[model samples]
Target: MRAVTYDSFAPDNARLRCGEVADPKVGPGQVLIQVRAAAVNPVDWKVMAGGLDGMMDTVFPVIPGWDVAGVVTATGPDTPEFAPGDEVMAYARKDVVQAGTFAEYVAVAAPAVARKPATLDWAQAAGLPLAGLTALRSLDRLAVGPDDVLLVHGAAGGVGSLAVQLGRDRGARVIGTASEGNHAFVRGLGGEPVSYGEGLVQRLRALAPDGVSAVADFVGGQLETTQAVLAEGGRHVSVADPRVEQHGGHWIWVRPDGAELAVLAAAAERGALTVEVARTFPLERTGEAFDASRTGHTRGKLVVTP
Candidate 1:
């Protein structure tokens, strides 16, 4: 099957190579997915750039991707939650560096796989695994309630966009930060929009002088600025930067849980959730996808349909 694999830690080494690699053998508690769409994420670029090189090793010929949306082609032994033909979406585990969603097939643990929502297509579903779960996990940490006021940074990006919708569904008043171009989109997601620029903190303070009840920084560098504007005792968390604790705030890491995905998928089915696909590229254009995601200020999640 065709997959995106890199030989070195250098971003220049990135390429889409065609080769006849043997299909993955599913082990106990795993499911083989014939990937229809795989979402490109900041994490993908981080891996490609060797941010996790110490962990993943500067391993040559590594297929890198996590978010996947596809149909089950085979089920591993003792897997009883799903059948071979079930449509599923998931985030692959960090431990599996070689086996990823960049290919036409990926063998994902059953615990990370969940039925795709009936309301979403393959591309939309593909965009949910990482960013979507991160947003949900942060909200879960804050215990977001209908009456709460929450702030999300990079509101136009994948996680921020989902956080806006999820915050609204949970009955919170959401304030989202983005550039001028995404104001409408942010407001449409039920967030009060704040423009992101050099004076971001000032803009937020002007709009929310009393501060918000919770603060979630999806964009790492913006943590200090956002946390500065948080209301006293507000829940502060981040998916990218673990240093939030140094600021006397909190942090959250998105965990892969089938039960969590089940709840999130059901919410999507009930029209309480949405996944935004900013752009999509053909499998052969994986290089372009990585470039855009790494260099551009993306409006939403990028996807690759192999």
Candidate 2:
């Protein structure tokens, strides 16, 4: 098996070095997936940079990828959810390190894997699991609805794009913050776009005369601005920093749930959800993929295929 790995922590130490390693075999209650595509999330590279070291205990030489889409070549004896040949997608775990989708194959716990939507290609399915689930978890905390006004910061990025669409699907009048360049793109998804910059507060007020019923911050900065703009009792949630809660906002963290993933997959199948792959790199170009992910403000998720 060939995998991208880092044996030590450094700000820019991540690399894709190919080596002959043993293939992963299924374990009890696990599924061995022949990985098709692996999506790059900011979390992946953040971990690579060792930002998460204090928060997690792990050995060096760990393979790091959270959002994975692949096929089940084998399954654990105790698991009943999937069989050989099933197409699946999963968010592995926060603590236990993953062999990861960077490899040609990896073993994932059955509980974490769900059938990929028939409507999505490997790249698309691969792109959505982590970002989409983070968006879903954030919006779930907000509970915006038909009469509500929901604002999404960084609305043109992968999670923001899906959050805007999901808020609309749930009947919220959605407003999203993006630069002028992405206004039309955000509008196409049913979100009213507001320019985000120095005067973002004024821009938002100008567009939503009624007031924002809920604010979801996908962009990690100027959270005080996002918080101040929310309507009275409006929920402010983020997938990023939760300390904003101290300033009268809510923080959201993503956890793996096959049930929620199944819902997302079903929505994608019904044409209610879509994924954007801003870029795709072959396995050997994993370094390039990590570099692309490091570039802040990518329009959508980037992917790597093994």
Candidate 3:
């Protein structure tokens, strides 16, 4: 099988190479997927660079990716949730870091896989799992709802874009932070767009003098901004920075749950959620895909077709 792998952690990502590798093994309660599309995320490159070495063990020649939209080709012993030919999408993080979604085939735990919505194409489906889960988890922590004024930092990026839509779906009046260039894009996602950087707090106060009821920080480095604009008793959560805990806010790390993925898929099918694919690369160009993700300014998700 053709897959991308790195032999060891390094600051440089050019070490990622696409080559022939042995097929992944299907373990108990797992399914083998014939990958159609995979999404590149910041964490993919970070993991490759040893950013997560303290959290998860890595095997040499590590394949690095987690978001996948594919078809089930086989199921392992005791797996009954799916069979051959089922279309699925997953945030397929494994305990070990050997087999991954950046390959022609990946074997993942059945519990992490969910059926892909018929309404979404493979690339869109591939873009949803990890970023959608991050947004959903942060919003869940903040308990955003009607009567709340919710603020989303980095609202034009992958997770932030989804957070804007999800907040609006929950009846919150969402104020999304983006560059001046992306203000219109954020508004299209049902958020009141606010330009990021200097005077952000002042601008937000002008929009809601009473202050925002919740803040979802996808970009981090905004603890001060979150504190300044949050109303009394307001909640806050972040996916990027752990220091949020010091400010009485939650720091979220998304976990793979088939049930949650199914809910997101249903929302996509119902036209309540959407995934944007800003660019795509063939499997052989996985290195370029990672390079694009490292830029950290893409308006939407970057996908790789295998």
Candidate 4:
């Protein structure tokens, strides 16, 4: 199978290369997916650069993706949930960081696979799994409700964009932080946009004078601002910063859960959620996709179609 691989940790995705690799073997409770599209996330590049070296063990010549949208080519024994030809999407992060979604085929645990939303094309579906699941978990942890004013940092980015829509769906008034250029984009996602940096605290205060009821920090380094603007009894969570945990906030790490992903798929089908794809790259150009994600300025996801 053809896939993108990195032999060793290198800065700027220096080691990423397209090459042939052995096909994955299906094991019990697993499903083999013929890759249609895979999403490049910041973590992909981070892992490639050895940023997560102390966390997840990595095997050399590693395939580098986690979010996938594809068709099931086969399913392992005991995996009764799906069969060949089933269209699915998954946050296919294995405990080991070797076999991954950036390939012609990938074998994933059945529990991580969810039927793709018909409304989303392959690129969009691929973009949704990791970012959507993260947003869903953050909102659920914060218990965002109709009366809450939800402040989302990095609102136009992958996870933040989804968080805005999900927060609005729950009837919260969502205020998001983004650059001036992305303010309109953030607004289109149902969030009131506030410029980040400089006067962020004042801007958020102007929007919710009493303080925001919840904060979802998709971007790190905003702990001071988050603490300054959060209302008493409010909750906050950060995917980028674990220090949030020390400040009475939760530091969230997304997990693979097909059932939870199915809920997001249903929301997409119902017109209540959408996944934005900034651009699509061919499989061999996955290195370029990683470059785009590393810029930290894309409005949504960067997808690679295999």
Specify the highest-lDDT model's number: 4
Q: Give the clashing residue pairs of candidate 3, or none.
A: none
lDDT of 2 by residue, 1-306 (tens): 887776766677444465656787778999988889999888777877778778887676767688889998998888888999999999876455546667788888787788999999999999888888888988888877788899999999989999998999999989898889888989988999988778888888887766788888887875777766777777787778767888777777788777889889988988888997888988778778888877777888899898
Candidate 1 residue pairs in backbone clash:
146-171
- Per-residue accuracy of model 1 over 228-281 as CA lDDT, tens digit each: 788887888887778888886668777787778878899899998888888899
Candidate 4 lDDT score at position 22: 96
What is the model-wide C-alpha lDDT for candidate 1? Answer: 0.84
User: In model 1, where do residues sit more than 4 Å from their true spots?
Assistant: 13-16, 56-59
Mind giving the per-residue lDDT tens digits that candidate 3 earns over 1-306? 999888989877667889999998998999999999999999998898899999999999998899999999999999999999999999999888777899999998998999999988999999999999999989888888898999999999999999999999999999999998998899899999999889999999999999999999999899999999999999999989899999899999999898999989989999999998899999888888888888888998999999
**Candidate number that wins on lDDT, 3 or 4:** 4
Please, what is the TM-score per model?
0.95, 0.96, 0.99, 0.99
Ten-residue stretch with the least lDDT total in model 1 = 11-20
Full-model lDDT for every candidate: 0.84, 0.83, 0.93, 0.94
RMSD (CA, Å), candidate 1 to true, equals 1.6
After superposition, the stretches of candidate 3 with alpha carbons farther than 4 Å from their true spots are none
Q: How accurate is candidate 2 locally (lDDT)?
A: 0.83
Off by over 4 Å in 4: none
Quick one: ranking by lDDT, best first? Answer: 4, 3, 1, 2
Cα deviation in Å at residue 165, candidate 2?
A: 0.7
